[model samples]
Every structure is written in structure tokens, then in C-alpha cells.
Target chain A: GQQVMQIPQYQHVQEGEDFTTYCNSSTTLSNIQWYKQRPGGHPVFLIQLVKSGEVKKQKRLTFQFGEAKKNSSLHITATQTTDVGTYFCAGFDAGNNRKLIWGLGTSLAVNP
Target chain B: SQTIHQWPATLVQPVGSPLSLECTVEGTSNPNLYWYRQAAGRGLQLLFYSVGIGQISSEVPQNLSASRPQDRQFILSSKKLLLSDSGFYLCAWSTESYNEQFFGPGTRLTVL
Candidate 1:
């Protein structure tokens, strides 16, 4: 099984501030996907990065994949109260190909 | 449009009781299904996944097991629930190509 480590288990920022979380894997990844789970809600897919050094943006959210495909990051600009939740990054291990290696996640709290 | 469903939005069970959680995806065929658990203040953990009917894969060894009786149905079961089993359980489905996964509303289980 592959392991993905996430940094800064939790963060708290004022509304309109910025937040970022990083996901790192020890091995190369076939693809990486990001998800967000609101308080007391299910997780929703945010984005997926397949190509190395790929960068994608959705509204105020930005996703980046490392050049080596073993790391990824999600950056939220001008966060809002709606952004308060847990953000998780899951990686598909090139070795296993079937199982997704999940990061511990970074829980964000936005204060107005 | 596709949707994923999970029943009993929340559950409270005594330790040692049997447990069964159902997950279903609509409007898709031959989808890849997955089961994940998120504990308090922790990240998402992959539990099981299925690629097709009657094909299931367990990512971790625990008191829980999973089954895919139909192409779009995935179920998680346990002979006896443990206190540690309490958490948020999520079911997700992705296309056969293994891209982003859409998650269900989730079920919060509390074992005492």
C-alpha cells in the first residue's frame, strides 16, 4: 500500500484570507484527486491532476501537481465561510493502480 | 446526471452489534466504487473498492467487509461493530477510466 502524508493537519483563517494544504507521496503517482468535506457532510470531488506539473483552477480554488507526480497542493484564495471543512488529497499509486492512497487531510476553519 | 446514495444518514449502535451500510450509484454502468472512513479529526481512509459486479477488494483488514452484488451497488458489512468503528463512512463512484470520484452524503456511525 502507498502512503500519502498531508501537512498542517488543521488551519484557521479569517474570511478573505488564503489557505493551502500539501500532499506528498513517497512514490510516483498515476493520478491525484482532491476532495472537500464540509462539516457533517459527505466528501465532494474537487479536482484531479494526471499530468506532472499540471495546474488547474476552479473559481477561487487552485490545484497543482508536482513535477515528479509525487506531490500535490490545493490553494484556496480569499476563503469564505463556505470553505470551512476538511480537504483531502488521494493519490493513485502507480504500483498498485487500484487502491488510492489518501492523505490525512487538512481541516480548514474560516472565521468571519 | 449521476447520483450516489447512502441510507440512514446517521446510526447509533452498541458495540458487538452487527452492522450493514449500503451504497448505490445511479445512471452509470461498470463504475468503480469505493468505501472510505474518516475518523474524528483524521483523514480519509480507504477501506474497500470494487471494479465490477462480484469483484471486491479490501484495502485494510478490519472487522468490516464489503460486497458488490450488482454493478452499481456496493455494501459494507460487519459481523460485530467496535467502538473504533464509529466514524463517517463515505461511498464513492468513478468512471471505469479511474478519474475523479463522486461521493455519497455519508453515514455517521456512533458505537457505544
Candidate 2:
């Protein structure tokens, strides 16, 4: 089974601050997907990075897949209160029925 | 827009009680389904996944089980619950050709 480890288990920032979370996997992933879960809410899909070194952005959120395909990052710029939540990175290891290995996640707290 | 539904938005049960949570997908067919659990202050953990009806796969050995009775319906059940089972349970679905998984509103379960 593949394992993905995420760094900075928690983050707190001012409304106009920037934040980022990193995820690393033990094996190369077929693809990586990012998700955000607001407090007391379910996880929601944010974006996916398939190609090596791929980068995608949604409004103020940026996602990046490491060139090695074994790591990824999510960066949020000029964060707001609405950005408070746990950000998780999931990677699929096609080897075992294509099961997903998810990062524990970074819980973000934005102060207004 | 596609919608995924989970019932009993919140539940409270006692030890040894039976547990059941249902999840269903709409606007999609034969999509991959997944069951995950998130403990407070923790990342999401994969419990089970299915690629098709009656093709359930367990990610971890636990007190819970899952079944897919229909093309779009997935169920998570436990005959006897444990205090450790208290957490937020989430269901998700995705296409076979893609890696982005869309999650349903989670069920908050508390074992009292």
C-alpha cells in the first residue's frame, strides 16, 4: 500500500497571509488530487495534478505535482476567512486496484 | 451538477449497537465509490472502495464493512460498534478515467 505524508499539520494566518502544505509519497503516483474540508463539513474536491510537475490554480489556491510524481503541494495566497479548512492531498497508486493514499492534511485557520 | 447523498447527517449510538450509513450517487453510472473516516483533528482515512457493484475492497482491517447493492448505492455497516468507531464518515465517487473524487457530506457518528 502507498503512504502519503503531509507536513505542517496545522497553520494559522492573518486574513491577508499566504500558506502552503506539502505532501510526499513513498512511491510514484499515477495522479494526485487536492481537497478541502471546512470545519464540520465533508471533504470537497479542489483540483488534480496528473502530469509530472503539473500546476493548476483555482482562484487563490494553487496546486502543484512534484516532478518525481511522489510529492505535491498546495499554496493559497492572500487567504481569507473562507479559506479556513483542512487541505488534503490524495495520490492514486495504480498498482493495487488503483487505491488512493491520502495525506493526513493541513488544518488551516484564517483570522480576520 | 452531480450530487452525492449520505443520510443521518449525525448519529449517536452506544457500544455494541449496530451501525449503518448509506451513500448514493446521482447523475452518474458505474462510478467508483469510496468510504473514508476522519477523526477530529486528523486527516481522512480510507476504509473501503468499490469500482463496480458487488466489487467491494477493504482498505483496512476493521470492525466495519461496506457493500454496494446497486450501481449507485453504497452502504457502510457494522454489527457491533466500538468507541473507536466514533468519527466523521464520508462517501465519495469518481470516474474510472479520472482521479478526482467528489465527496458527499459526511455523517458525524458518536459512540456514547
Candidate 3:
């Protein structure tokens, strides 16, 4: 079975600080997707990376996919109170297209 | 424009009670549907997915079962609920297996 491991199960950072969460897969991935779930809300799709060693950015948030396609990271700069939420990364195995292997996710808490 | 709908934003059920949650997608044809559960302060756990009507794949074996009677309709049911069944259940739809998913608002289940 394919598995995705995420680091820093929980993080608490003050406003204006930076935060990063990493995701690693046990096998090669066809693609990786990132999502954010605000408090009391459902998960919302943020971004997806397909090319190896690709990087994408959305305002203060940066996402990078490893050259091996087995690891990914999300970094947020100058966190705000609105940035408080749980971030999840899901990966699709190159050999398995039926389902996406999901990480346990990283919970981010920002203090104002 | 696409939308996903989930009924009963919140539910409270006693142990041993039967459970049913429904999800539907609008403005999309033959979309891939998925059911996921997330315990408090935990990560997402995939329960089931459907590629089309009557086509379902279970990710984890539990007391839960899923059905897709219609192309865009997915249902999660349990014969008898347990205390561990309590969680945030989310329904998502994707255009393809490797595409980003659109999630419903989700249903909060509290088993007593």
C-alpha cells in the first residue's frame, strides 16, 4: 500500500512568522495536490504540482515538488490570523490511479 | 460552474443506530465521487470512491459502506453506528482521478 507522510503534525506560529509543512510519499507520485481547511469548514483545493521539481506560488504561499516526485512542501510567509487552518497533501501513485494517498496533514495555528 | 451538495450539516446519533449520508454533484457529468472522514484534530481518512454509477472502491475496511445509485449521487451508510463513527464526513467530486477535487461543506456526525 502506498503511504504519504507529513511532518510537524501541529504548528503554532505568531503573526508575521513563516510556516512550512512537508509531505513525503513511499512511492513515486504522478501528481500531488494541496488543500486547506479553515476552522469549521470543509477542505478547499489550493494547488497541484505535476512536473518534477516544479514550484508554484499563490501570493504569500509557495509550493514545491521534489525532483524525485516523492516529496513536496508548502511554505507560508508572514502568516496572518486568517491563515489558521489544517493543510493536507494528497498524492497519486504512478502505478495506482484509483485513489490518492493522503497524508495525516499538518495543523497550522497562527497567533495574532 | 460546479457545485457539490451534502445534506444534514450536522447530526447526532446514538450507538447502534443506522446512518445514511447523501452527496450529489451539480453541473458535472460522470464525475468521480469520494467520501472521507476526519476525526477531531486529525487527518482525512478516505472511506469510499466511485468512478461511475454502481462503481465503488473502498479504501479502508470499516463498518461503513457506500453506494452510487446515480452518476452524480454518492451515499455513505452504516448498519449500526459506534462512538468511533463520529467525525466530519466530507464528499468530493473530481473531473478525473488526477485532478483537484471539489469538496462539499461536509456533515458533522456525533455518535453518542
Per-candidate TM-score against the hidden true structure: 0.94, 0.95, 0.98
Return the candidate ranking by TM-score, descending: 3, 2, 1
Over the true interface, candidate 3 deviates by an RMSD, in Å, of 0.7
Cα lDDT tens digits, model 1, B76-102, are 999999999999998999885358888
How many Å off is the CA of A10 in candidate 1? Answer: 0.9
Q: Rank the candidates by lDDT, best first.
A: 3, 1, 2
Give candidate 2 misplaced runs (Cα > 4 Å).
none
DockQ sort, best first: 3, 1, 2
Superior candidate under lDDT, 1 versus 3: 3
Docking class of 1: medium
lDDT of each: 0.90, 0.90, 0.95
Q: Model 1, retained fraction of real contacts?
A: 0.70
lDDT of 2: 0.90
- Say which prediction, candidate 2 or candidate 3, comes out ahead on DockQ: 3
- Please tell me which predicted candidate would have the highest DockQ against the true structure: 3
Worst 10 residues of 1 chain A by lDDT: A94-103
Report the C-alpha lDDT of model 2 over A1-112, residue by residue, as the tens digit: 4689999999999999999999999988889888888888888888888899999988998899989898999999999999999999888875653677889999999999
The model with the greater DockQ, 1 or 3, is 3
